[model samples]
Target: MSGQAARNVLWIMCDQLRWDYLSCYGHPRLRTPNIDRLAAEGVRFDNAFVQGPVCGPSRMSYYTGRYVTSHGAVWNFVPMSVGEMTLGDYLRPLGVRVAVAGKTHIEADRTGMQRLGIDPASAAGVLAAEGGFEPYDRDDGIWPPGFSDESHRYTQYLRKQGYGGANPWHDHANSALGASGEILSGWNMRYAGLPARVDEADAETPYMTRRAIEFIEQSGEQPWVLHLSYIKPHWPYVAPAPYHAMYSIDDVLAAKRVPRELENAHPVLQGFRQAEVSRNFSCDHVRETVVPTYMGLIKQVDDQLGVLFDYLRRSGRDQDTMVIFCSDHGDYLGDHYLGEKELFHDCVTKVPLIIRLPGAGARRGAVESRLVEAIDLVPTILDAMGADIPDHILEGRSLLPLLRGAQPAGWRPAVFSENNYAFRDFVREPLGRPADGCHTIMVRDHEWKYVHFEGLRPQLFNLRADPEEFDDLGADPAHAPIRERYQTMLFDWLRNRKIHPTVSHAAMTEWTRKEESAGIHIGRW
Candidate 1:
């Protein structure tokens, strides 16, 4: 096994997480017993998705597998520049090592020397700025030097899971964890005043699974790859203590979304879908106050991913290890009325695709509906260690043939998701403003879903007769030729790909006033 490559390539990843709240995507209640035991030991992909439904263009489509408008990295710190190419610049020139821990946002913030779009070998020569977007109005050097950016970093990892204050990352949301960071154990929370946590053997999702089992017990021979990354179910949804009473937020369900999905749909889910249901996103007020706070942060990230896969199956190394758990996008808690999620819907572009290729060639517990994408996870993690996959910037196509169970040998007809919200005022620069930005181009494939809207109005769902897309067959009259054959398959998928910096016609009309630029403006999608 060591000769075939993967001496180590863990790769976890989460943040804003949501792929139907786990329990192996059935959700019914969202317990996520260590991602349902790594989807019962690996290979779970029921139509995975995420290439920018938010969060730095889906981490620049898994470090450049392309599409986010031909990878200009379109918005959110716009980095990933300087001669793009990374899977950590292709596995640190092959000897591999790599590393990467939690939330590595693609690009933003650059000090003089001009050349911004990042990727000057994705830094580590000591570069800072890791999450919790600062305040007192962020942006002069984006978030560091923080005096206050008005909470968030799960409101300082949930007031450091209420373990007394002393700086639960600078306290304040009514400041009071009296003790001092370190109690928060697991499973507790019915609600009311709610404050008793600190125990899941001292949180921070098992302190980054004890630094990924001490980086695989200090990788002493080399050939590693790590990439941990796990911000957790996302949001102030605290956890620790029986995964904050493991799922009981009024029984949890919600997330369906079809009800006419707001007429003239898909201009990025038109006005963020919401026609009938309200009451601040019902379902018993997001299951008793926002899904018992996102299943108490996804049951403390399924008990630190079962303490790093039970310390890689009790150090036997579970067949030279090759686990993967995804999610860089997804979070639409109240669904339609919405909470967070740049809205592409599927509760924010699907997500949650497990993979664990160890012995007996993966798929042990099974479940793979296909359609995967997060830029096909760095070419199915360089073809699960057989490595060697390179054709330069591959736009994604190596799921190791659907983890070798065979399918998708030539798959993908509709596996794309885009975003460029007026590039979030250079991603929150001076707090940003210009608005009106919209540019979604979904394609769904099987079971009819066409969502095409550069400016607005163009949707045609039938996810098996409205799986909550309610019904906006664009302007039905008998679904006018299934909306012109998915608008010529979204215009031959943008005329056979290729875009970066190409948005021009007087700069797309000084920022989409479109009809071909009428004003001297300069902003919007």
Candidate 2:
């Protein structure tokens, strides 16, 4: 480790936040000064993308530093395989205390734990149950009618704050008092403009930020990594007072769509277009009503970050703690005529990634336009901590070289992301595809983007010509060569995925061509 290397890491992650919405990323209306400050004092990546478009799969990739297929968590509510190693698994053994403050969207592998006879109360089992992080205060933030049980921490906290109801999360936190004195559910787009009943200080974002601050204060002098994950700027998009009224339809960006996208759309895309959220977002009124609140939620998140960053500075932890701010995935916000994130578009796939490395060895106020993925963060954190990266397990390269202002040789050319739409009603009813066959992969380089579906027609976009990706040329014969080349690249990527995580690359190298010397040779050599 270098003398000036950061001693701790504060990995702050927001859910469903777009890359372009931040002021640092050129948003004209919504100014995120705190996040912009981080970018000014650090490195802001222009082309960072997540491995999956949805919450569960995208967050799984971020936590484990592996692609969605590699981690075996293909969709929401799907538990990652028990054998997968996460950032906590890698860092805890190195004497770094790893903890999480908010949402991870990780479903526990209970069946695997039971099969292996792992006690749920044991330390090893606890770590495995929570996707390797020690949960200081974990809340996924999606509370439906019957889902919010007594054990839900956030609901309990809300109730303690004098908000009483069977489901306080739904009634108070994600709801608003309408003009007629009726409770307006945040789930309804019509009520998005209403301010939530909860106070701004007690909102989900502020509560999670407070929890993160508590974790940091409790950690003391120990070297640690805190995954301060926020659940807001996601669905149930109602912001508390002040923030809810901060912006209106005037500040909402125009929905990026055209008539050509609806014509002869891919079969899978057709299913998505028929979805309720997509149809709702396709309406001009719905976009005007809902997007303002979405913007407000993002602004609130930025303000809370300001609070968190100020605390770090006041506590003097800013000197040796690395601060990384990013989102799990981007929200569609009616982009390309789609709502919520499931398809591969720049609005859904690209995320804002800003890293403020500690001390003099780190680069400051730099912008890197290289194609980087969510999987790259685990190795980056390890590299920053001076820990050896296990190449056999982690499939991402460290960005430490880039942070130090040096270009690493053999950097990736094209970034990859995948999606599984089997869980959606659209995939089941409209597409009529089996669960296993609903997979899709996207590969993109500097000038071109290609989407390959399992049983559907491919999609090709010349990003240089149509940066908004309004036009598709997958069927055009002139672009056939480009599509074929990108398909080949995707195939190569899949074929070379590191499947054997149990053994090290160094061990395999030592055993190669020396198998006969170490053990019995195959075919009786």
Which candidate gets the maximum lDDT versus the true structure? 2
Clash count, candidate 1: 38
Models 1 onward score TM values of 0.33, 0.97
Per-residue lDDT over 288-313 for candidate 1, one digit per residue giving the tens place of the 0 to 100 score: 65576576677677777877777778
Global CA lDDT computed for model 1 = 0.61
Reference-based TM-score, model 1:
0.33
What lDDT score is found at residue 331 in candidate 2?
Answer: 78
* Candidate 1 Cα misplacement greater than 4 A, ranges: 1-12, 15-197, 227-231, 234-238, 241-284, 291-329, 337-347, 350-373, 380-387, 390-414, 417-482, 485-525
lDDT score for candidate 2 against the true structure: 0.89
Off by over 4 Å in 2: 1-4, 512-525
